[model samples]
Target: MRDFHLLIDVGNTFLKWGLFQPSAAGGARENRLESGHALLEEIPALPAQFAKYPAPSRIVISNVAGTRVRAATIRVLEVWPDAPAPYWLVPQAEQCGVKNSYRNPAQLGADRWAALIGARWLLGPRAAMVVVCGTATTIDFLSADGVFKGGTIMPGVGLMLRSLHEGTAALPDQGGEFDEYPTQTVDAIASGCQHAQAGAIERMYAHEASHVRDLTCLVSGGAARAVTPRLAIPFQYHENLVLEGLYRVSMSL
Candidate 1:
C-alpha cells in the first residue's frame, strides 16, 4: 500500500537506516518496523535488505559521507523504482522549530542538523547539550527556545587512537580498556582518549548550564559506550537520533 517511509543516515563510518510506519501519536514517535546499519564497504547489502519490504511511499536521507557514498546509496536504492525520489536533507537556517545559528548554515553537517531537530523534539523547551560520538565527536549546545548556538568537533575515540598509532612510531594501534591510572601504554592511550571525549563534553555542559537553567545532556552515536561512562554529569543516550530527526522531516511531507 506504499505506507512506509524509509529513513537513511549516511554517516562517515556507517550507513544506518530505518523503515518506519506513521504513528497515531506523532511523527517524532513513529513506529519503527525494521532498521539496519552497515560499514561503508557493505553498501551492496542495502538493496537486498530493502527487497524484503514493500515499496515505501517516501524515502528520507541525510548524507554526510561525501560523494562516493552518496552515489553508492543512490545506486542501491534502485530496488524500489516506483518510490518517489529520495528526499536529501540539507541544513537550513531553521527547520522543524530549531534555528541554526551557524555563521554559514549550509556548511553545517546534515547529520548534526538532524540531530539538533531530534533533540528539540525529544527535549521540548529544555536547554540541552547534544553530543554525538561517531567518526568525529560533536559537542553542540541547543537553547531551551530551540536555537542551535554552535558546537565543536574532535576526533572520535577510535580516530584519536588511530591518529596516535599512525602518527607515531611506538604507539600501539589497538587501545586497551579504560582506566583512571594505567601503568601500560595501551591503557593510557585508551583512558586518555575516553577522558578527552568526556572532558570536552563536560566542559560544554558546564558552559551551557551557566547560561541556562536545567541544562540537559543528550548523547548519541557509535562511541557512546566508550565515552558515556567517563562523563561526570547526567546524560540520556539515543542510538538513532539522526534517524529520529529524519522521520520528523518526513512528517512535513
Candidate 2:
C-alpha cells in the first residue's frame, strides 16, 4: 500500500492542504505531516508543493465552495493530467467508524464531518464536543460510542464582526482583536463579538453536559485562539482537524 496521502480542505476563505505518511508500528510519534494555507485562486501551486513527497496514489478532498471545486479540479488536471482525479468526500448519514445523527444527515457541513472523525481519533470514542471556529463556527457532538449526534452552526467571530459593520449602522468597522475585558468602543465591539461567540459555545457545552457523562471539548480553526481563553471547560486544540479527517478518510478506503 502507498504510504503517502494528500488531503485538501477548501473553505469559504482559504484552502488548507496537508501531506501525511503512514507511521510504522511504534513510530506513530515520528510520522511526517506537513500542512499550510493557500488562497482559493492559488490552487495550481499545490502540485508543486506536493512534488516533494512520493507520488500519492490517493487524494482526498472536502470542498465547500462550488467555485473552488471547479477551480481545484482544473488545477489538478493541469498538473496531474494523467493521474486519477482526487476523490471528493461528502458527509453522509454514516461513514467508516462514525454514524451521523443529524436531523437531515447530509445537510451537515463536510468540515463538521471531518472534524468529528479527527476528534474521535484523537479524543477516543468518548462523548466529545468538536468546536470549529472558522468563517462559520460549527459545534458538533459525538456520543461516547462514536455516534455523531446533531450539532450547532453559528456565524464565526470574523463573520459576526463583519456582519455587525455591514448589516447595521452604529457599529464601527473594527478588526478582530479583543481585550481581556473590553471597555472602550472598539474593545466593546471586539469583546462583545468574542463573548457572544464564546457564550454560544458555552451554552452548547452545557446542553451536552445534561445528557453525556464525559464531555470532551476539541477546538480548532482560525478563530480558536480568540475563543479558547474564554471557554469554561478544558479543551484540546487541533490546528487542522478537517485536514486530518480528510487524511483518515482516505486511509479507510
Candidate 3:
C-alpha cells in the first residue's frame, strides 16, 4: 500500500480527520485524500473513512476529549489493518517556532495550542486572535513574536441554547437562524446566542486591536458559521485551522 499522512483532531463533540499524500518540497502541495467530520457518537462510520486512504506513514492526533472519547478514537483506529505509529500531540511550553505563555503548559488544551501554531504559521507574524466555536467557544491571543498568550473558553451556541431549555420550562432546546429581530422564540434564541458568542469574540478582538498593530483574527470550528456573520470586527474564517496546525506539527516532527 502507498504511504500517506493522517491528521485527527478530536474536539468536545466532533472528530475531524484528513488523509494526505506527501508533497514535493517547497512545491505545490497535493490536497487531502479525504477530509470529513463526524459526531463522536456517529463513529461507526470510521472504517469507511479509513478505507478511503492508504495506510498512513505518519499519524498525529490532538485530542481534547476525555478518556471515553479517546478510547472511542482508538477503537476506530483498531480497524486499520496496518496501523501506523500514532503521536498524540500534547501541549508544550513552545514548539514549531511558537512560544507558550500558559503558566503551566500542560494545562493548555492541545487543540488550542495547535490552532495557535496553525495561525502563526499560516498567517505571518502579526498579532493573532483565534476563535474556535464548537461545543464550546474559545478566544485566545498570540503576540506577533510567537508567544501563545492564553485564551477564554465559554459554552457554545448549542450549550447556551440548551442551558435556557434546561433551566426554564418554556424555552425549547433547538437552534434557528440568526436574526436581528425575530418573530419566533427559536429565532430569538438563535439571535441572542449568536450575539453573545459574537460579543465575546469582539471584546477580545477589540482589546487586541487596541494593543497590537495590524492584528489578524482567525475563526474556526464547527459552530464558526453560526456567529461569524455577526462579527462586528474584521476576521477570517478557516475551516481547518486545527488540521493546518497538525500539518505544521507533522512537518516539524
- Top candidate (TM-score): 1
Best-performing candidate as measured by lDDT? 1
Per-candidate TM vs. native? 0.96, 0.88, 0.93
RMSD of each: 1.4, 2.7, 2.0
What is the C-alpha lDDT profile of model 3 across 142-181, one tens digit per residue? 8889988788999999999999999998998886777899
Q: How high is the CA lDDT of each candidate model? A: 0.89, 0.77, 0.84
TM-score ranking, best first: 1, 3, 2
Please state the error at residue 77 of candidate 1 in Å: 0.8
How do the residues 182-237 of candidate 1 rate in per-residue lDDT, one tens digit apiece? 98999999999999999998988887788789988999998899999998999999
lDDT score for residue 247 of model 2? 64
Deviation in angstroms for 191 in model 2? 0.6
Q: Mark the regions of model 2 whose C-alpha exceeds 4 Å error after superposition.
A: 1-3, 24-30, 44-54
Number of the candidate with higher lDDT, 1 or 2: 1
